[model samples]
Target: MIVRGVRGATTVKANQEKEILDATEGLMRTICEENEIDPENVAQVILTVTEDLTATFPAKALRRLAGWTHVPVMCAQEIPVPNGLEKCIRVMITLNTTKAQSEIHHVYLNEAVKLRPDLQLTKDS
Candidate 1:
């Protein structure tokens, strides 16, 4: 199976540790569910938070998932671009899967939906 990347993003109301962790966990769960990803097949997870979100590293939340201990997870600060969304957390998961790239689901939650309206999850999704 070829490796595929699943992208997801969400925004937190504040920079608190709880808010960041909750939002990251929610986003990770949605991405796995939507894409039918197996945690064991996950090669790596890279998490990024916008400049305004400095309360904690988003990658810390992924540790709460089962079978993620061996997965290589990294966290970094997002580049401060003009007009960028604030208090946002993004995750890109690399996994081994047979699914085609077009069939992969990208999740965007909260205000992050504005970042990619085309990939927005609808009520029926």
Candidate 2:
């Protein structure tokens, strides 16, 4: 199997802990569902949040998901760029898969759709 990266991002209305955790969970689930990823196949998950979101570590959301407890997850601060999007949570999952890189669907939900307008996928997509 080859290693592929699934990318996803979502925006939170506020920096509250619940909002951050919920947004992170939603983004992670969509990425996994879109890519048909199994937790065992996931090598690592990296979650990053914009400077404005600090109420909690987004990685905590993953641990709450069934079968994700064993998955290695990390959380970090996103680069504080000038005029950058705020209250944003981004995730990149590295997983072993038989599919080609092009087959991997990158999810961009909520206000994060602006980050990758080409994706054209939202909460329902």
Candidate 3:
């Protein structure tokens, strides 16, 4: 199997610990579901949050999921760009899979939909 990267991002409603964890979990779960990814197949997960969000580490959310305890996860602060999105959390999931790069779907939710309008998906779609 080849290694593939699945990207996703979402904006939280606020800089609260619960909001960060919930948003992170929601984004990660959607990415995994859309890509048919198994936690065991995930090699690593890198999570980043905007500088304005410092309430908690988003990686903590993943560890609470079943089968994700052993997965390697890291969290970092995104660069405080002058005009970048705020209260946004981004994720990159590296996993072993047979799917091609073109088959991987990147998810952007909430206000993060503006980040990559070309790849946007909707419940209706």
Candidate 4:
């Protein structure tokens, strides 16, 4: 199996811990399901959030809520550009899989969806 990374991002209404964690967890689940991921095969996961998000780190929530204890996860701060996506949590999960790049799916959810209209899962949006 070759290792590939799944990219996903989601934005919350505010910097609250609960909202941030929930949105992040949802985005991760969606990406995992779409890519047929096996947690055991996951090499590592890196998460980033805009500087405005100070309530909590999405990576910590993933370990707690998703039971990714065996998987190595890290967190960082995203560049805080003016007028950037607020409370956004971004994830890059490197996992071992047989799928090719063409078959891999990336996700952008919530208001973050507006960041990449071309990549949205459906045209009906």
Candidates in order, TM-scores: namely 0.94, 0.94, 0.94, 0.90
For candidate 3, the per-residue lDDT at 21 reads 95
**TM-score, prediction 4:** 0.90
Query: For residue 123, what is the lDDT in candidate 4?
Result: 16
Q: Per-prediction count of colliding residue pairs?
A: 0, 0, 0, 0
lDDT digits (tens) for residues 1-125 of candidate 2: 99888888999988799988888888888888888889999999999989888799999999889899898899999999999888888998999999997788999988888888776455533
What value does the lDDT take at residue 85 in candidate 4? 82
Q: Give per-model CA RMSD.
A: 2.0, 1.4, 1.9, 2.2
Instruction: Please report the candidate that would top lDDT against the real structure.
Output: 3
Q: How far out, in Å, is residue 15 in model 2?
A: 0.9
- lDDT digits (tens) for residues 1-125 of candidate 1: 99999998899899899999998988888888889888999999999999999888888888898877788999999999999899999899999999998899999888888888876462121
lDDT of 3: 0.88
The 0-to-1 C-alpha lDDT of every candidate, in the order given, reads: 0.88, 0.87, 0.88, 0.82
User: Residue 28 in model 4: shift from native, Å?
Assistant: 1.0
Q: Give the poorly placed runs of model 4, Cα more than 4 Å off.
A: 65-67, 120-125
Rank list by TM-score: 3, 2, 1, 4
Cα lDDT tens digits, model 3, 1-125, are 99989998999878999988988888878888999999989999999999999889999999878899999999988989999998999999999999998899999988888888887463211
* TM-score of model 3 (CA atoms): 0.94
Ordered by lDDT, highest first, the candidates read: 3, 1, 2, 4
Candidate 2 runs further than 4 Å off: 120-125
State model 2's lDDT: 0.87
